[model samples]
Target chain A: MAASAGPEIERLISLLAKLPGLGPRSARRAALTLLKKREQLLNPLAVAIAEARDRVRTCSVCGSLDTSDPCAICSDNTRDQSLICVVEEVGSIWAMERASAFRGRYHVLGGLLSALDGIGPERLRVEDLLRRAGNGEVREVILALPATVDGQTTAHYLAERLGPSGVSVTMLARGVPVGGDLDWLDDGTIAQALRARRPA
Target chain B: MAASAGPEIERLISLLAKLPGLGPRSARRAALTLLKKREQLLNPLAVAIAEARDRVRTCSVCGSLDTSDPCAICSDNTRDQSLICVVEEVGSIWAMERASAFRGRYHVLGGLLSALDGIGPERLRVEDLLRRAGNGEVREVILALPATVDGQTTAHYLAERLGPSGVSVTMLARGVPVGGDLDWLDDGTIAQALRARRPA
Candidate 1:
């Protein structure tokens, strides 16, 4: 529907519609909500977005996003520099950080090597990863990519490349999740759990 | 989890988290997506929001949001000037516009009169509506408010106030929605639909 609220509000609605989960209807609702709480919400949100646009930068070493070049994780000396967890995107880095389980450094590959899409190691940061691994500091290069075909292919490729460099290559464990019910578990997950069963 | 992406990105995420359907996790993902496509998405979005903030204003006569003083709908001379649809907010105006059914003007009440929340007629545009009705131009005032208790109370109050002025006060019909499933229909909707049933 053509917006009766004028072009500026319409522009805001269209822009908000580009967000991950927001559709045109919800974007219109969000625009109205922001307008209703202009002083409290809209102004602050606008400022924050503008500041993020001006300041946010990708880490040159790893591909994580931050205001700084190397990012806070890469610059911090306390983190385990010997362990480099490889991921496909910056969002995975944030997810890993949220878990608070891994205390190692990260390497964002930008994307997986998809043969169907013609993406290869040249398109990704595989050369940078090999160089980092060859440098005597890193001992283990963890492949924290997805379980999909492209992810597996990329993992295998990386393992072959990093093997000669003396860095151990490992993938995330595959099994049923901790709180998952066996009755609801898919066949693939059940089989993996059976194969990876540990002693009590 | 604490954000390692720095304060600016964190600020954007927190602000985005306050949107209607987004939570902390989705907001973080949205932020990363925005940052990843900064030139294409984030910059334009920030500009749009800033423009909306600077230009959008509440129409003095109807309480609807617009860049102009009277809003496009309010100033349009082609619409039915004798019919005024009273709604609770600007979002409802957009919904009504999407239907492409109404050809009249609108009066936004800002919110319904909620006694439990201590809201009364004074806090709304009830006085402006009364003034507009008494101007001897409006022949009908349609209450397009929600079906909640507060919505009904506000409609009743408006009807009582406008009864002596010789202006017709009406409400939107309550019935089952056009494409609603009978099995999923609530008791209230079923009763309303049955009461309003028409002979084929």
Candidate 2:
């Protein structure tokens, strides 16, 4: 007898549909693709999911998902303890790691200070970051915040608050990304913005 | 203390890199995307994977994976028992189902007979299909095989063997898909070459 389409496949489709840029059609295609390649893809994927589920946990000190509290970076003696890189989200921290540009310890602010969304410093990990910094090991703070208005506001808020504490504050340079287009630049006497880039 | 990176994350990155269309960068991005959306996407995806791992099984009769053997189409009594549509793979079966054009039984050949790959009739589900057809309920067989040389060879072999068994054989109508063009034509041309379709 033909069996009814059951809850298991239905649940898988529903979860897959929730991914960014995926809808029901793409979800169905992906599910079927995974099903067809069960030996090479599906089995390993299942095992990976199980292992990650068992091992992943939130770092109590930094709120980054790690297997332990204080995470590896926070506990690493070789990393610069005095220099903290503050980011808006865990994803941004991962992006920084991929760039391999910064070796400093990280502090995830969870989100920006957004008045429209009613998000303020109290809603973030800013207080914890300040407390940790006040322990006197932190000497310099690098703000790797997004360039949005709320991000800039949050950066300013931290700079004003931490400046009086005698910690040097810096921001990541803002300009063109490593590979950006000049043709997309608008208007102008074009004479001014070109002169601003320095050999930092 | 900061712990160094471990083999688990490395294993995940390597495995994810092998997925279709995902390079190392996109794989890393996707992995982090899943992690950051854990409550919304990752956890539920994990749950679904676990559930599917426990429930999915191959149809003993057709070699298709489903929650039950003989699948939904095989078991449905209202579908035409006298007509069996032979297809190359489960993907084709799913595509046909999406069209909602055929209301009949399906016999998945698993693959076309390919000399280059040294695949033969014995390597396909041809034996199982023959056994099922010999039971005498089927009166018509539709060769919904691809129009590739191997696919045509497989279709011809089936027609030759099945002709003496007293059954009428048919194939899909010839035409571009409703929105498709001749520029996209390939294996499908064999079907399309059979006729110019009248506007329905």
Deviation from native of the Cα of residue A140 in model 1, angstroms: 0.5
Top lDDT prediction, candidate number: 1
In model 1, the runs with Cα more than 4 Å from the true position are none
**Per-residue lDDT over A1-200 for candidate 1, one digit per residue giving the tens place of the 0 to 100 score:** 67655778888888888898888988888888898888889999989988888887888999788888889999999999999999999888888887899999999999999989999899999999999988999999999999889999999999998889988899999998889999998998899889999998
True lDDT of residue A171, candidate 2: 92
Task: Classify candidate 1 by CAPRI docking class.
Answer: medium
DockQ for each numbered candidate: 0.75, 0.30
The lDDT of model 1 is: 0.90
lDDT per residue as tens, model 2, A111-160: 99999999988998988888877879899999999877899999999998
lDDT of the candidates, in the order given: 0.90, 0.74
Could you say which candidate leads in DockQ? 1
Q: What is the Cα-based TM-score of model 2?
A: 0.81
Cα deviation at A8, candidate 1, in Å, is 1.3
